[model samples]
Target chain A: MTAEIKWVFLYSLLTALATGLGALPFAFLRQVSTRGLALAESLAAGLMLGASFSLIAEGSHYGLTQTLTGGAFGGLLLLAGKRLLDGHDIQFGEIRGAGARRILLILAIMTLHSFSEGIAVGVSFGGGQKLATLITLAIAVHNIPEGLAISAVLRPQGASLLACAGWSIFSSLPQPLMAVPAFLFVETFQPVLPYGLGFAAGAMVLMVFLELLPEAYEKADSENVALWTTLALVAMVLFQTYL
Target chain B: MSSTPILSLLVAASVAALATTLGTIPLSFDLKAKRRALSAAYSVAAGIMIGAGYLLTLAGLESRPSACILGAVLGSTYSFWLRRVTGSKKFDDNDLESIPVEPKEVDRFLLQSSFHSAAEGAAIGAAAAVALPLGLFLAAALAVHNIGEGMVLTHRLYSPQATSSHPNAVPAPLLWPTSLPPAALVVVTKLPQIVLAMGTYFLIQVWPEFLPLALGFTAGALFFLTLTDLTPFAYGQGRREWVALLCSAAAALVVLGQSFFL
Candidate 1:
């Protein structure tokens, strides 16, 4: 196998193991209060804000008209997606007690989310090395919460720990699955590279506004949310300077 | 042994990694006060990102408008496809409230979020790895941004309840767990993404012909983020709409200024 393939295998294995092992912490923490949860949510909001600014803004430096046009296109696409999927539903995996339609809907939503993440990974790789590592790390950090969210949803449905683990693993399967292929033969797929990156960026931007930020507002006080957001920005600045 | 290229790449990668890690530190705090602090941080980071994109990516690829348009179209189309395939679910207050306290579930959430962040980091690293000085600068900026993201995410998972009870709490001392499984997971998953990102950079490094395309692709990603994510998030709530707009404008201006002055 090529050196690149070896790296891909290692990454995929590590990600799966980390995700599975990460789940163990919750068992010990037991119960977290609602107040605590809100605080955490706010923080997450801030971090996303910082990330969006630092990564996306930096991305724009490549070109003005082109970047702006691309951004506009991406925004419109997200809006379109929201409109199309507004009331639609689908399902996947093993269905417990929920109707087949509901299960399908859940699965579909999960797939959509995961696919966006996969695209992000693919795009980040376009940058190569350090940039890719940064993107991967950021995505991985964020995935922990996503895994928790998925587990919470599945737990009520009589899903076992192993099952939850499986789902969590499945949810992120697209990241490495996509990354490895993209990396191994980026030359062959050169034509679509820019578009793929753009798609991922657009999707991520949409996710932050449509999902993450709104959730932050719902859970935390306005002031607290604002503060966390600011901190997130500061953190970004500091990281840039120090790193 | 003129290893300037490799040396610079290492510098860029390390810097990117550190920035992302540092940015994520505040996220571990589970306090309401800390959350607000994190939000403010995000706004600033957003400013930096917007500025960087305009100054670096846009300036570098000014020759290729068509590629940029194409990139954007592809991005939006993909997002549309995903949405069509899966219905959107709005997260409620109750969902947030139940986050931190719940056992085992939090771990999964953290892992997923971290994974996402790592992917972003990898992209930044790759950009730096290929472009050298220009990419390095962007990577540095992105590293800072990723750190903020990490802080925000960490705070979300740790203190979900703090927001609901004290909407106006003062910023508190932020403390992150030194040995969380999620953190380790984030670092581990980042390894390959970084490598792939570097490989991409290598390709670009070898063939200067691809610079325009690379720049265009990066521009597309940034542009999509600014218009779709940052702008909307800034304007989402009626109260923060103006602030968001101002921030967005300021961010753009910073880049404009850099283009002319820097």
Candidate 2:
């Protein structure tokens, strides 16, 4: 209703939309070879690795113990979720079986993490409009790699580029949805921010080791996989540091 | 007064050498026992390395939290480079070229030894630069830690079958140069501590503020070892669930131990 709330919603929506840009690079590739897919997965694993570390670092700015404890719980939760999902045959739209399961899992994780980013955007606004705008832009830029990470997994498994982009945006939908409330109640959201960041980070890190890295290793040479993963991690960390 | 740091470096490096030597003493045992315990040992070592690195990271965070991440990136990048370079085929010439493309346990063990030694040496140097007592404490703790690592290194690298020249016979690469006698293997592996410790000493002397970054670097390197190398190798040994549990338990042990002591 208010102008400030409208702005918050709009900015958050913009951030969510930025995620679709991650899939843009996928357009340049004509076909996906096994090695290319493996490297892509490695890139995703590295991005997740860097993102998780950054999340922990950011959360530690508030409270280290809370962040780490939240990370442990987050990892456990993801593992438990994976176990539960394994019991049922999974289908996500046109995707099915293992591919469908992986898609659903990554989507669930990215969405879960976006909630923290949404709250972050909301909380930044409480500091001032200038701060809010800067944080929103940074997050929007950051979401591109995250989108790429999602598309890396989804596109190779037969999802269309359009579908991948749409799913990427969909995964980030939590930003606008959670931002309004967090902005309205900054005090309430601030305390829980670290835990949420930690949770997202923990789950993402576990997912990299459990899913992406393993798959990368299986499909490609271990040496190449390590190289791609490390390079991607270094790039992501530097990106977060500078941006 | 200025020489105290340099002097402490020698002391720390000497302690590490002694500790590592003691750790490798079990290499003389029968091969089957070592093979059986290999995965379990790696699992425990992985956990301890993570714990120790995390403790160092926490200490670094106390003064400069942000620097830890930068340090971590640098450290992990170093590890990645180390793994890449070491994994190359020309590290040595041996008859094991025809073996099935199983993971190179020899290269992994070599990287683990050198990488960890350098990281721990830097930690010792950085800590000592801050305070002699702190440096000495870390050296002693790491000395104890290196013993376990030494044990793992020897077990993984020194099996009787590894020394043979036949293509069909040698499953793993020989632990040392073929020309070098078996007795020299111990000397060669333990050599990294003195060299890396000296190098780290010079680094700290040049930049006093390198302490936190050094700690961060150590943590990052350790994490790389666990996630990229050890986890997969351990899993390959079979019983994924137990390997995971042991890794977790060892990590918890180090985390808890350091929390109380450090």
TM-score of chain B of 2: 0.68
For each prediction in turn, the share of the native Cα contacts (below 8 Å between chains A and B) that it retains comes to 0.00, 0.07
Per-residue CA lDDT of model 2 for A121-213, tens digit only, reads 999889899999999998998898999999999988888899989999999999999999999999999999989998898788667756776
- Per-residue lDDT of A88-197 in model 1, one digit per residue for the tens? 55333554332233223333344444443454455556676677667666656655544554454444344566766677677667666666666666565444433333
Query: Weakest 10 consecutive residues, lDDT, candidate 1 chain B?
Result: B87-96
Residue runs of model 1 more than 4 Å from their true location after superposition: A1-243, B23-32, B56-61, B76-98, B101-119, B122-131, B159-182, B189-193, B225-246, B253-262
| Residue pairs in collision within model 2 | none
Best by DockQ: 2
- Per-residue lDDT tens digits for candidate 1, residues B1-262, read 2477666766666665555456444334444544444444455455555555444344333544444334433433343333233321121122222333233233444443333333344345435533455556655655655565555444444443544544422222122232454344345434443554466566556775655455434433443343333333333322232334334444544544443433
Could you give the CAPRI-style class of model 2? incorrect
What is each predicted model's overall lDDT from 0 to 1? 0.46, 0.70
